[model samples]
Target: MEGICFLPTFLVIWSSSTFIVSYLIALFEHDVDVIFPYISEIGAKPPESCIFGLMTIITAFAGMATIYARYKFVEKLNEKAGVPPALNQAAFWIGMLSCLGICFVATFQETTIIQMHDAGAILFFVSGVLYTTLQSIISYKAYPYGCSLALCHTRTGMATIAFLAVSPTIICVLLHRTEDKDYVFHLVSAVSEWIVAFSFIFFFTYIHDFKRFTLKLRTEFVS
Candidate 1:
């Protein structure tokens, strides 16, 4: 929605709160010691299933908010320095595609459409990696200009993204062994998923400075 850009902080709160609550709901549904069970089993149940679906939908809106803010943030940076327009636009639209992927995954549950869900999941994570990597580069460059993020922020953000980006490979490598060995793969995948999830959280920490970005808009003369 056009209004999504108007309330960036609201989007952050909505997305963060919804995800935290939904995860809590799912976490309580099963055992706590193992990550595999949490990754694979928790969301398929009654209340958690509903919560998961709602969280997915909220995430879509949150993604929209992210796109709205991210490019605008870069647009301002571009004015201070030279940032590739293509890179900024690419980051925004690709991020949007990730949001669409989240919606697709939510609509088609793994039980009903595993292939589609997996595709969506892949889209979300892959696009997220590209979007973050591109913006991180831009931010690092813009640091000399006026970007408020500290060096540590950039370093941590990149590290978290790396942790997340490496996870799919782990899943692919370890997912197909025999039952005895498969749990190891599942555990790795589960850990990677958590890394990715937290990476997202870590990335959004940049929101603290978004208020410095002046919202750009166009209006027609009403004469």
Candidate 2:
């Protein structure tokens, strides 16, 4: 159980470190603006791009593990509470799709494949927001079993903020595209992207619940 808790904790730490390290390298190389550069921009060029792509790939795997563990955890609780599994199942699939988006973003560099990179970003944000929203509802539904009211509220708030932030991010990105070097729109989009991304990561703070559950595997051989 304790070991399972580390999954989400590691996801948070590794993802944040990936962004920070890539950002610093890009900054020192004068590859990005000092203020509010798009998260993808820092990873668009040479050495930093390599690190970003590799680390983000690992982060995507970590995210998948954390999300799957969470899905199982909620499923168990819902089963015990005699609640239907539809919502939990939906959330699990949506979360997996969001992680797939992360892989897409990591593989497609913005400079080399701008269309793919943008598509990946949009997929990640939209799926992530939906995932969190569904999980928040699941948390409330599972409250009587193991989830706390406070945790439910926290998840709800973070999901709402991520949802709100994504709208401005998309709007500003589109607006920036129409203009010539509009730093203001770019800055707004960058800031909003950070907020949404971190909010998605932070929602994994529910890792505390993982302490009550264990993940195990069994192998069987068939003749």
Candidate 3:
């Protein structure tokens, strides 16, 4: 896990930057309404399409790597302290499912396969929330497991993240309340999507333990 922060940090910055740029491009190239246009609308056209596709590949790999690194790190620490696996294999497999959803969403544009795209989006969000929450819990309990104080210092932030992560569910209620106002529902949905994204990014920041790992070249032969 040495230098493990690099890829996750890159993935966050890359995904955020590309999505923002692509969303801007989509606004100019498509008939996208500013407030209500879903983030997926960005992938409906232009340089946006290419950006989304690239973002997807980068994110998929990075997300999987992040999961693996965190799980293995936690597993090792837990083993050392004689604590059973905190999140365990279930969390890892669930994370992989989330990765699949992310890849699916990126590879197929919502404009092309609306149902499939929506399904993927749903899976990604739900699984991501679950995964992050589980990791947060595991980290909270991982005292003396060599998790840095900074990494485990998510007390106040964890509450904020929990509140933010409920954005989509709250939007669901709002969506039903504003049944007749399509624009309002759409606008709310867009906001909720961004909320989820930001919350997830912040949650990953809590996994600062990877800073302890470092990479080095091994000159050993691959016999």
Candidate 4:
């Protein structure tokens, strides 16, 4: 049961390490620019791309597990507090969609399937920010019941940063593409993308409530 508490931590480590290792491999191989390359660019080619795709596929499954655990944790908290389940349910589905987006991004290489890769990136960032914001709201609403005010504030702050980063990410990427591949816009876009991605990752760190819960499997027979 207590071991479940580490799931979120594992997810964070695995996801962050995947990107970092891929980035280093791409850097050493001279596949991407030295300064603020888009995360996808680092994994756009072979070798690193293979590693990135495989690791990210695993990360996506871990993300789904983590998000589903959080959803159930919140569901229990809401049940205890007599809070409506609407927000929690919404957050769960959106979080799942973000994980699906990750699969798309991982499978469709940016250079090979640029359109699908870009679409996946858009879905991931947009839905991820929304999911975190909704979870933050749920945290505040469930305050004093398996959640602390400080945790609520922290989630809200992270969500705000992620949400703020999203607009600049999209706008700067578009600007970089349209403005003759302007380096400034590209840098800003890359920075914002990293911020948004990590913000979403770190938000799951507030899984202290998971310590008290355990997942169990039972066999059933149907007639």
Candidate 2 lDDT by residue in tens digits, 1-223: 3758888888888999999999999999999988889999999999999999999999989988888998888877876664458888888888888888999899999989889899989989999999999988887777778677888888899999999999999899989989985988998999999999888675466677888888899999999
Model 1, residue 207: distance off in Å is: 2.5
Q: Considering lDDT, where higher is better, how would the candidates rank from best to worst?
A: 2, 4, 3, 1
lDDT, each prediction = 0.64, 0.87, 0.69, 0.87
As a whole number from 0 to 100, the lDDT of residue 60 in candidate 4 is 91
Off by over 4 Å in 4: 1-3
Worst 10 residues of 3 by lDDT: 154-163
The list of candidate 3 runs beyond 4 A from truth reads 146-181, 203-207, 214-223
Inter-residue clash pairs, candidate 1: none
Q: Global CA lDDT of candidate 4, please?
A: 0.87
**Any idea what lDDT model 1 has?**
0.64
lDDT of 3: 0.69
- C-alpha root-mean-square deviation, each candidate: 4.1, 1.3, 3.7, 1.3
Model 1 ranges off by over 4 Å = 1-20, 27-40, 149-156, 159-165, 168-181, 216-223
Which tens-of-lDDT digit does each residue in 12-123 have in candidate 4? 8889998999999999999998888899998898899999999999989998998888888877777666546887889999999999999999999999988999999999
Model 2 steric clash total: 0
- C-alpha TM-scores of all predictions: 0.79, 0.96, 0.81, 0.96
